[model samples]
Target: MIHLKKIKIVETSEGYGEEVLKKGFEFECGHVNLMVGDQGCGKSTLLRMISNNSKHLEITLADHVITKGIQSYYFDTEKDNPRVKDPQMYTSLSGKDEGIGYVGALTSRFRSHGEIMENMILDPLKDAKDCVVILDEPESGLSIKNQFRLIKEISAAVERGCQFFIATHCYPLIEAYDVMSLEHWKTMKGEDFIKLAREKRYDGTEKDNSD
Candidate 1:
């Protein structure tokens, strides 16, 4: 029901300018969007920008976030120490329009992937309002059944007023969360390198294979 309303990007040197990306280069979106990539693109960067802003505005390229991640994360640990604040996540225009549920980490709950996706992840949020949920490479840890369950969860979330912005290099995830694939995100983190992203998320004429 509610949208981000205004999405303005700030200027950065040697990259797409804010005006051009919003008005021209980038096909802008809101709470629910999907991003795909080949190897190295700016997908993660965009997600970080979106998620970092806690004003009912969310952008996520990864599976999860740690709140003000730039200053809060020090090698996967907290610095400023911001935990999952549910109301804050749902205080935006988007949240009021949708009945959203905000939970903390999905990493600490289950022992198996299936249990994690169904019971821990999807089951809990099935009734929550979710105009969007930004997820990073969810396929990295899930099984095929788990992935399918994830798809079910996403579909349910969308039907309930939630959208998603997911970042992934996995084929199954791409197919599962196939509503959109803006592009890939490229960045090196802790000796690892990510490749190009698809929409500025992956852009292609191919339709997603999932229902």
Candidate 2:
């Protein structure tokens, strides 16, 4: 299991001279840690701070610092950039020397946004363990069926011991994981966040649509 015991940020020259976006925020790592909040509510800010400010934060796995290279996989769904070159490589590397027909078929199959994510993102990390996956609103371009598929894929990865930090507003996606709602985080009140983090299980019935 992984643990994030605290996060602290300071701005010396900003309006308030200094501010703490997060302090003593704690969560036990699980298969999924869904972060839900309204726009500009510091959800993405927290993830970025964790991913980039490793030097200043105290995050650990099994009593040791998490120092593995590429231990975190971030999928910024807002960008939606497709890798047009990878399909050619995938076909050629697949060793199916059946020529252009195979390549064409493979290319056509991954045209949808969800299929591209499955082939390019999820498939590669499906079996990953003891790592963190940070996704920002992955439901952006996915259909309901594809969203369900994404949930299953994430769950499978979680079963393999992967930890997820997802920032999303999709109701169905929110319903599918243990969520920490940031609706009140901007107020710097840690009670609600702590409660959700400690629960660490969605149970599929709790609902919070304010995000």
Candidate 3:
């Protein structure tokens, strides 16, 4: 397993300049590691920095050094920027699906966001091995039911020796993984967050919609 001991970003030139993290933010490494918070709380920023493998960021790994080019994959529901740019890249990364013919047309035209994620994200993860997979708000386009289903896909990837770093607010995801709250970069109790989510509260404020 890829054991990420800690991460610290001191300057903007290095990575996401968000200063939400205290110096030397730390967490225990696990099969499914999560960074959870409301929007603009720096979750995506941290994930972005990790995905870029930013040299300026101080990332202490129990197993490997960050500069040695560890094989990693990054997936955002909004972007399909995987570490390796294969021919099968999807619109989730580039804002445009560059596929052609039947498969391409189907992916870009007929599929909903959730279906597209399943085809482009979860499908690749099904066979991922011995690498880190980073996801930013992966539950963006899924329904509550699909959010739970996403957990199954992620769990399968974990069983295959793939370590995951995910940024999310989805209650199901927070409930299913070990999570840190970007609000303080401290361990968060999933049960508490789940209770808040059920009440449509995020970041301690009541949201207008239900979970």
Candidate 4:
């Protein structure tokens, strides 16, 4: 299984730049790391940076270090479509295709938005034993029921040795995972964080930016 020990963003270019995350923002990795914060708080930007295969970043795995994380699989909810069969898309650390062929075979059965999103998030877990799967707001089209169901699927994947880095605003997802709050780089736990998040959303206290 692939184990990411740490990641430090030393530099970033374009779109929000270093303001989103300073040069020294070092994050200790988790089995299932959830990046949570208000909209445009650099959640997606951080994910993009990790998947950019940048040379300026430092990625430390359990067994070795790498300059670029090209082996990581990134799925942007707004940009990446699971229905599209792109066999050359992602490759696992084990040097195998990250199951895009399976997506082609199964995407025909998923016609709804929720189904597509579900397939997008779950299909990789099928063969991603030593792969790092990064997902950006996968709950965009999923119902609340499916959101919780996705959480369950994630937990199952974790047990199977697939590490996840998910960026989302879904309360259930935030409450269920190990959250890295981008607001202050503070970690928030269940219940209280959810309460504060809800209050902020209803009272118009949190600022929303395009991430």
Candidate 5:
């Protein structure tokens, strides 16, 4: 089981220079910890820092080494500047690159993305010690069938004692994975946010418009 014991970011120069609070949240062993928040509540920010990369945030881990050991993966839906990047605070944190051992999953909207994640990554890494995965909206472009497959893959990985750090707005994830809703996870929860994610799962788009 891999759990986060601490994450304290004081003054990270890697991200936009702003006074960031020293923050840390703990998780249970080998569980898929989902973060649901509004578009700008820093859910992604918190995930990245947990993944060992947060710009301008000072991060200090209670356990640099875990019982399973220390490795991580990331699948960023928005894998570009301003959205995802190596936290500049790297230099100040430990004087060593925290992202060094992490495996960053490919960011693409291709139909085979789910397959790639299952076959190419999770299958191989699940047995390895210290492996963590960060899935950011893994279902963005997948069809309903494919989305189900992704869920299966994630569930399987979690069963094998692999820790997961995920950021997503997908409703299926919220329900299927039983991920906590944004209202529950984030301080800001609205009817619209919940409705949108729910609709995505049932595909309430056309119905909503017609009504």
Candidate 6:
């Protein structure tokens, strides 16, 4: 399990004021923790703050810090750019004549979006234990069917003791796991507010906003 006491952010972009999460939030590992919110609601920022590989943000993992000796992988689809344009180039780069072997099998050597995700991001870490996987909108180019498939893959990883911190707006993906809704992070007036609510299970019904 991992606990975060607080997270503070100072906006250095000229003219933008400071924003701080004075109270912070906490969530347990060993299960998928989904973060859902509107754009600019700080979902990605919070993920960055908790990530071990983040360069700009400073984070302190308080009690039950399991990050030490744990292999962490962060997959940001927006910034992913494969140098090889085709399967032949990939084969040459990888030094393999056939398809790129992944997840204990051979997959397409072509550089399609979904294939890229499986080959570069998901397949390598699916069976890992005691690791932390952070994905920022991994459902970018996948179809609805593929999104659900990805969810099942992640669930399997979670069952194997791998922790996942996912930042996404996909409704089906959000419904498929334990979720921490960041809806209360902002108000109609556009100010920072702390409302951390954890839903241990999603019942396939509409989200409850009574809190």
Give me the candidate number with maximum lDDT.
4
How does residue 157 of candidate 3 score in lDDT? 72
Any runs in candidate 4 off by more than 4 Å, and if so which?
16-18, 64-71, 82-110, 201-211
Location of the lowest summed lDDT over 10 successive residues in candidate 1: 71-80
Ranked by TM-score, top first: 4, 3, 2, 6, 5, 1
Per-residue lDDT value at 70 in model 6: 52
Candidate 2's residue-wise lDDT over 1-211, tens digit each? Answer: 3434333443222222122344455555555777776566666666765666544345554444435443566666544334333223331112232133445556655587666555544555555665667777777667787778778887777777566778877666666555665654432223454554445446634456458
Candidate 5 C-alpha lDDT tens digits along 1-211: 4445433444433352222322332323225666675565456666666565654444333354533346566556545211144533121111233331123322322325454434333344334334567767666656677666666776776676566767777666656544433334322233445665555634433235545
- Which ten contiguous residues of candidate 5 have the minimum total lDDT? 89-98
TM-score of 5: 0.54
- lDDT tens per residue, model 6, 64-98: 55344455666566654243333332222122343
List where candidate 5 sits over 4 angstroms from the true fold: 5-30, 53-68, 80-130, 178-211
Ranking by lDDT: 4, 3, 2, 6, 5, 1
Global lDDT of each candidate: 0.41, 0.56, 0.68, 0.72, 0.50, 0.54
> For every model shown, what is its TM-score relative to the native structure?
0.48, 0.60, 0.74, 0.75, 0.54, 0.58
Highest TM-score model number:
4
lDDT of 3 at 192: 70
Comparing 5 and 6 on lDDT, the stronger one: 6
TM-score winner between 1 and 5, please give it. 5
User: Each model's number of backbone clashes?
Assistant: 43, 0, 4, 0, 10, 0
RMSD to native, candidate 3: 6.0
* Model 4 C-alpha lDDT per residue in residues 1-211, reported as the tens digit of each score: 4467888878766654546776777888888888887787788888877777466578777763354433567878876665554544745435665556665647545578777676666555555555677889989889898888888877877777778888988888887766887876766675566766665755666746556
Error of 2 at 19 (Å): 6.8
